[model samples]
Target chain A: MAWVWFHRFGSPPHFYRLATRLTPWFAWPAALLCLAGLIGGLVLAPPDYQQGDGFRIIYVHAPAAWLSLMVYVVMATSAAVGLIWRMTVAYAVSASCAVIGASFTALALATGMLWGRPMWGTYWEWDPRLTSELLLLFLYLGYLGLRNSIDDVGRADRASAVLAIVGVVNVPIIHYSVIWWNSLHQAPSVMKFGRPTMPAAMLVPLLLMLAGFTAYFVALLLIRARGELLRRERNAHWTAEAAGATATG
Target chain B: MSEQRVGFAAAAAALIARDLRLALRRSGDTLQPLGFFLVVTALFPLALDPQLSLLRDIAPAALWVGALLSSLLALDLLFREDAQDGTLEQLALCGLPFQGLLLAKTAVHWLLTGLPLVLIAPLAATALGAPYEAMPGILAAVLLGTLALSLIGAVGAGLTMSLKRNGSLLALLVLPLAAPVLIFGARATALAIAGEPLAAPLYLLAAFTVLSATLAPWALAAAVRIGLE
Candidate 1:
């Protein structure tokens, strides 16, 4: 019985309908939480004793960085699922993940640089986290480029799925190795992990923003997945009926 | 399942030997990247001030970058000819395992492209004013580093094999993934130049090389199969 449900959910037309039904559940709460988190973080959160209000960038930066990493894991997992199960919906989900992850990575980098300029006196430092994040951006670009360059959707999905899986394996190695490399060169910086030391006031809003961003990602992913499913499944009878219903109704 | 099938080791050896012979016959495929390595390293001196101290400081990194670009320049050749001639399909259909064949191809690629880079690294370092004391560590690092690069490059080469023109695209796909090799390789040499303990970085490079060597051939084989399909 569960297997039947799973297969139905995996089907493009069924998944498309499910995504449409679910998008609003994710989107509105995400938007509201983001607004509340931004206001709470930017205006209400107490300024840091050491760094002052410049530390406020953490509200945006940390969440974006978290989302960027989380999204890649999601993308790679979905890609692997697609590869193993031969599920087109899974491929659509993975394909939709690339651009969103890239945007979050770019946001993280930009906000990080903004925060860095005031504190470190340089716009960029070859710090481990920053460097690894930049590398993650490159990995995203490579995945997108590979996908776009191939004309056949199925081939693109298979090839890019392989790259994503390979990259997922490397991400941890890249992260830890970069950290090791950084330790030899410089002392630990202000932008390193903050879980243990950060005050609750600061940590709370950051967590809120993180949750909000993740919800936003889910909402956006479903929206994008629907479009991808439509295009990829256009030849199917269900998609044609759905298109006609939307057109006429 | 057939009794007439060639043994895996024998088949792998045959593939390696075939690739090596082809590379040797062409000669240009092997030497062109070596020339590119030398020229790229040579240009750094002309581009920068000829101050020996500055050159020495930058030498490890410069040489590593040169090696990386040169290896990338040669990566496209890894599967291109076989792919063009349908040899890849024939090999895939043969009784030998795809992973073993890919491993052999990667080994031959490293021998032709990466081995020469490792051999000539010292000369590039010397030209760039890397200290004499750093030579052994530089050599060891390059040797391990280039092996890792070739193994990793095989996956990239396989991924891009079906594309008609993929020079820059191959580099783009490979370079970011290859970052650890560059980082550890350059740092190991730098530590050696500074007379610091070389154990950690060299160990890291060795571990990375081993990890890539073990894992990459499977991915390469998969990518090659996808390209063939």
Candidate 2:
């Protein structure tokens, strides 16, 4: 039944209904996790042995950075699924993810520069990691621009899908650009497999924050997906009812 | 065992020949990109100083960037006429591969736009006081990189022709993806100006060209088919 419900999510009306009902299921946990993680990260967690409190920015920055990339992969994958299956619902989901992903990427970059200003001695550097993130933002803007430029939804989807797939090559490029181009931004110290660079206390809060962000994204994505589905499916009877309720409310 | 596979050399030559003839009788179609390239290249010198050292340093990047934008400027012209006049539909209906036609068009575009840039670059490089050594690197990079630019631009052009004011939209699509090409090309020429080894970055430029050449036409064909459908 759960799997069946998951399958029904591709239907706009069903998904809209389910999302409205289950928004709380994700929201409560996301809020709780974020609140706890922020508290742990800000006060309870020990100051970095070297950098003191400055390192705490990682609690927010790292998870947002991870989501920035994760959201992109999700968007691209959904786009591919839409193109392959010719599913309008999947394209709607992909388009919604792109906006959320772009914002998260901007957050990650903004906070990263804030940390870098004090730590790296500069607010901006052409560091591959930072530059790649900037490029990712441009790719997102370009996708949206292309989407909006095409008034036709079907053509927009196909065009944006091609752009998404091609732009995906940059994900690997950006991921590896640090190694390839040589930059000051150090590689991931926490997500490594063997062991984390920081102590367990730092690592735990960071992981919790990451989980909190994951939940946040899932909740936001479903909400936006519902909006997109309603817009695209407004001709359908279910959409009219959903639109009516949302409008009145 | 009946028919031999067509070599790239032969196929490329055939395609290039086809486009040259198409543009020869229809010469006005090709002039806009050339004029745009000249005007854009001329803009930087006027907007900025004409000092030799300054021009020398910025020359390679400006020339390459101009070439890139001009080629992209011309990209919309690649498919719009075909699409507008329903020649694209006929091409689709024709037995010959549509991808081949796209490739042929791109090859022509490179020849018309790219070759002229290479030929004109030496003079422009002189105007900017680009050292003689920077000449080959600049020419080679622009020649190969512009081909890839048009190739990818063809894909973007195909996607956007069905839309309104597609020229600006085409640039938004192609320029971001073209960043690596432009960067590598500019850096390679810059390194040459400073008398450094460029073999490594030149290899990257060549690889980009090959990669785009092999892939972009297929994507363009797909976009055109989707638009038609």
Specify the highest-lDDT model's number: 1
Listed for each candidate, the true contacts retained, as a fraction, are 0.59, 0.41
- The DockQ-derived docking category for candidate 1 is medium
Worst 10 residues of 2 chain B by lDDT: B3-12
lDDT, candidate 1, at A159: 95
In model 2, the fraction of reference contacts reproduced equals 0.41
Model 1 chain B worst lDDT window (10 residues): B163-172
For model 1 the TM-score comes to: 0.96
Question: lDDT tens digits, residues B1-116, model 2?
Answer: 69666655565577568668877887786777777777777778888888877876787678778878878866777777778888779768765677887677777777887777
Candidate 1 Cα lDDT to native: 0.89
Off by over 4 Å in 2: A1-22, A174-195, A235-249, B1-29, B35-56
| B189 Cα displacement, candidate 1 (Å) | 0.7
